[model samples]
Target: MSYRSGFITIAGRPNVGKSTLLNALMGQKIAITSPKPQTTRSRITGIINDEAYQMIFVDTPGMHEGKHLLGKTIDKLAVNSIQGVDVVLFVTDRHLGKSETKILNYFKAISTPVILVINKIDLLKSKIQTDEIILSYINAYPFKEVVPISAASVTNLDHLKEAIYKYLPEGPQYYPEEMVTDQTDNTLMAEIIREKILYHAQEEVPHSVAVVIESITPNEEYNTVDVTAIIIVERSTQKQILIGSKGEKIKKIGTAARRDINKTLDTKIHLSLWIKVKKDWRNNPNELKRYGYQDE
Candidate 1:
């Protein structure tokens, strides 16, 4: 059989399990996911290598109406990512809604093949319900294929892979077999820290936070790494929420983040987290750029 390779973009509305589907397809977590909307603010690439094909999947920020400069920039990133990809995976958890319709409109202008992936089927009650959801989307647009699967449960994903492989062209491998993602170590570590905050912080605090790794120094004497990270928030009130009473909340977040860092990076390390208030940094273009949210 001939070898096949191509790029696929996972596009969807906020909190529709696009990131989860990407992680499941890659068989590992390269993107951070949370119950909160807009948890992903950038494009994350996950690569899958097999004997017959190489699939490069781009997990993009959820497309939505923007309330700030940062939101608007990331929304543009999601829309722009669909262009030039070999296949587009349109993910949704429910019937056709306003957000899904808006994304479908963008498909009308592109020639790229799109597969409607109805994720979170594990939450549904019956097969009839799943078919109803699929009919709603297929009626709105002619998708290349319709797949129903639960990303969290890893159900029916092999079928989805076969469908995606059908569309790829016979080509050489774009990346080495060992590489699974394009994200650097610093970016991955920073995102892992932010994920902990999203799980622990409440209300608007999670959305207002940005994490930056200042320094990562190896301590050869102790065979460990010492790392410093700065967490940026828009207001002092948000910082207080993260810190909690007697510094308990921040401590919990740091501990959880450190644990994951050790497992993901395969190194023992010390992590120090500092919270700083930047006062509406999301609206400031300079601040957005400094926090790694700028347009490429």
Candidate 2:
């Protein structure tokens, strides 16, 4: 029997459920999700392996105009991820807004097969509206396939996978079956911590916050790991807000992050979180590089 394997790049504007679709397809939570936009900051690869095929999915940061050095780097990552892929999953909601149109225009020029995945159908009121939305996209481009799915509820995702497989060529698996993601444990830890901050922090704090794992020490005798991370902010006022009165806010973020890390590590994790002011780190190229925003 012939085997099939390829890379599928998930592209969309910010907060359009790209991360949610990646997690749902993987059947596990490798990429972190929050209600905030630009929650994903890097090019993370999730592998789906089975008896007949291996589908490598690249979950990229949302495509949006860059507001700072970090934002520009993220936008570059998303654009770069679209290149040299076997298939591109252009994910969007029912609204064909300007950003979505821009993305569609960009994808139209790419040589790889582009599948229009209209996500969030679960939010639609009726099938007639879904059909109308599908028709609008159908007229926009000659897509290999147009699939409507609800990435949130995992509805119709199987059909989407089938649509992707239709374009995949027979090839060897790029990754081993045991490996599910390309991110290191340290990077994953930092992202998990950042996810907690995005979930708990208020206003602009989520965009300015960057968690750096300074150390991950293992205690062999106690079967526990000590994780020391520093959360970088732009100003002292932001630091004070993150720390909260009596350090309550930071404590809450740490507690939630620690729980999630413990589950991932399957061992007792001692998470030590600290706050620092970086004075517009997002705009500083050096600071963005230090925070692991450099392209790879």
Candidate 3:
């Protein structure tokens, strides 16, 4: 059988379930997801290897209007990811809006085929609602395929995969069959920690937070990994919120993060989390670079 492989970029606005779709498509959780907006900060590559094809999916940060240097950087990362890819999945969970229009404008300049993926269809009242959404986007731009799916429920994903496969070009496998993602262990650990915060933290606190793995030491005697992570926030109040009264919140975040890391990385881990204040770090270019957001 002939082999096929290509890169597919998942582009969308904030909180539209793009990351959830990526995780569902990969059949594993390489990408961290939450109900919060701007949860994804960078491009995450997930490789799905089948006997006849290898589909490399790049999950980009949500595209949105930026209020700070970090937000603008993330928007730029998402826009740039759409270029130089074999196919683009413009995911949206609702009808035409300002964000979708801005994304469609970019599609006009690029020749790459884009598939309109209407996510969260399970939330719709009826098939007519889904059709209305499909009509709205199709009228705005010509999509190669329109597939309505619910990423959270894992519905219609097989159909979506088939649609994606149709656009993949014949090529060699870019990654090994056994490999799933391109992210390093430390990056994954840090992201996992951040995901926990997003789930536990509320309001602006989650958006301002950044998690960095300080060190990862393996102990052969106990067959466990010792991980120390620092959680960065923009204000002292945010730190207090993360730490909570008597450190309860931080403990909850740490415990949840450790559980996920142990399962996802398939290794026992002793996780230690610390909170730090870096006043308005989102606007500080140096701080953004230090947190691995500027260089990308």
Best by lDDT: 1
Per residue, candidate 1 scores C-alpha lDDT tens digits across 90-123 of 9999999888899999999999999999999999
Q: Write the per-residue lDDT of candidate 2 for residues 235-286, one digit (tens) a residue.
A: 9999999999999999999999999988875768998999999999999988
Quote each prediction's TM-score: 0.98, 0.97, 0.97
Which lDDT tens digits does candidate 3 get at residues 48-103? 88898899999999999889899999999999999999999999989898878998
Q: What is the model-wide C-alpha lDDT for candidate 3?
A: 0.91
The candidate that wins on TM-score is: 1
| Candidate models: Cα lDDT each | 0.93, 0.90, 0.91
Better of 1 and 2 by TM-score: 1
lDDT of candidate 3 at residue 254, scale 0 to 100: 92
Between 1 and 3, whose TM-score is larger? Answer: 1
Candidate 1 runs further than 4 Å off? none
What's the lDDT of the predicted structure labeled candidate 1? 0.93
